[model samples]
Target: MRGLFLLTLALMVPGGVQATLPPPPGGPTPAPRLVSFAPPPSVVVCKGGEARVVESAPIHARIWQPWIPPVIGRAAHQIPPPPAPPTADIYTFSIDADGAVIDLSRPMAPTMWPGDEQAAALAKWRFAPGAPIKGCRLDLAPTTVALS
Candidate 1:
């Protein structure tokens, strides 16, 4: 886990990681990791190596967290307005040759949902890194967490 945390930290550091989304055509394209039940938009950027998801770590985020109950008022119209939804972003992670998540970042614009715990959880994703494939990608979107 420490390794994963360090790796996640490294990924957050600017210019510390090496993995690209699909570039303009004519360049070596990243290969899909495998046949996915969900649409796999990203791929592993390996050299003739194939990787399969040995195990997918479950990413748990409370959809509505820290719910603050409204104070009771006899007026009966004091129900606090519902909490607004938190902003979200798409985080793309890269798996290393060892199948551990080595890099994580928001390919899109910066978002409120910081990728800290998300990184730790994503780090646990296990992959079958055969033939030393350059590695594959996993994109995630975190929902606003709330206390039940």
Candidate 2:
């Protein structure tokens, strides 16, 4: 009776029943199961506050009188520019994630102040990479900044 029972049990059990899928046409499929999958969380750390000025551009442009001859002596060398009208243009700009200055614009640029030169100078500025910031103000000639 015991020998018969053992033989019956051994024959009933299946041999090497692997829980694997059929090979796919692309390649053998990976056996990883995505049970309750939640993607990893990401936190964006932004740098803010005042942007330090590393390289500074001169805000003043000197004027030289070409008509004044060399006979005028040292006085002809450096001629101070005429006083600019009380027109201050505030340039608005932002910094990108790569710390490069972007979105530079001056709504009402003064005639004497070259907007292109000032904007180009600001564009080359690179600060610490950070989140998007708006409402940054820069007084053109003075180069005063209120960056956030």
Candidate 3:
């Protein structure tokens, strides 16, 4: 009876068996690191009567999504009229592998003002070097003119 009680006591103790096992070994985990970037300098010269050089680019346009409230206004409060849309302006410009300029009319649309102006600027202008653009152009409409 004494020997049987000792055996039962050993089994009942916490970690009595697992404590005899060997410890596990360590391992490494691989990770990624970033590198540096450097760009070159460039200059643009515009000549002639409001001339611009616009290289075409892939249009990355997104659809305009406006959210409307459930009700126009509160029932009790009187609301003033919403402000009118700003006057639309025309713009034009051109781009190359390096850079671009805006407000060169040459019959094209505008760059700074609105979509319709930009479309008109694109339709009328021409480009040089024939390279692509991931760039932008900005200029006041009609009054402002550029040469590139």
Candidate 4:
């Protein structure tokens, strides 16, 4: 009974078993050391004049999606004025290989929204860097964001 209890206690203690392996031929391995280096400078330039617009992908919601307020019921004899329809302003710009906006053209004439607002939003936009486009044209459209 004493030997059986001792064996069971040894089994329960994880330190009772250990893994041993031969050291590497070189000797004990050295601790890993971190190496840091700066990346090469990236310079993207748009060719003189406008680049042919290969394909104008639809504006992604992550970039700019408008919000529409819900209509609440008013009290009797208290009719609330109808809400004005949301307006959309289209913008054109060029992007580089890394999706950085190389050159941002002025907003099309007669835009209800301000150009600076559109530019500020666009500055945060990024695209996959595969094929580099010289002067790509991007269109930004406004649409209501659906609530989940």
**True-structure RMSD, every candidate:** 26.2, 31.4, 20.9, 23.5
lDDT of 4 by residue, 1-148 (tens): 9999999999899888677754433322222222211221133234433333333322323332223233335332353343332344444556676656656765464323345655665566565454555554443434443332
Q: Model 1, range 1-148, lDDT digits (tens) per residue?
A: 9999998899889988678655332322222221111323234343354456676655554333324343433233454444444344455555566776666665664333445665676666677764344434444533432232
lDDT of 3: 0.36
Best by lDDT: 1
lDDT of 3 by residue, 1-148 (tens): 9999989999899767554544332222112222111111122233322223444322222222222223333442343333222233323345544434444443443232245534543554445543544333333222211121
Clashing pairs in 2: none
* TM-score, per-candidate, Cα-based: 0.41, 0.42, 0.23, 0.34
Candidate number that wins on lDDT, 1 or 4: 1
Question: Distance from true position, residue 62, model 1, in Å?
Answer: 1.8
What global local distance difference test value does model 1 have?
0.49
Decoy 3 TM-score against native: 0.23
Candidate 2 vs candidate 4, lDDT winner: 2
Identify the leading candidate in terms of TM-score. Answer: 2
* Model 4 residue pairs with clashes: none
lDDT of all predictions: 0.49, 0.48, 0.36, 0.45
Q: Where is the poorest 10-residue window by lDDT in model 1?
A: 28-37
lDDT tens digits, residues 27-53, model 2?
222232211112211211224456544
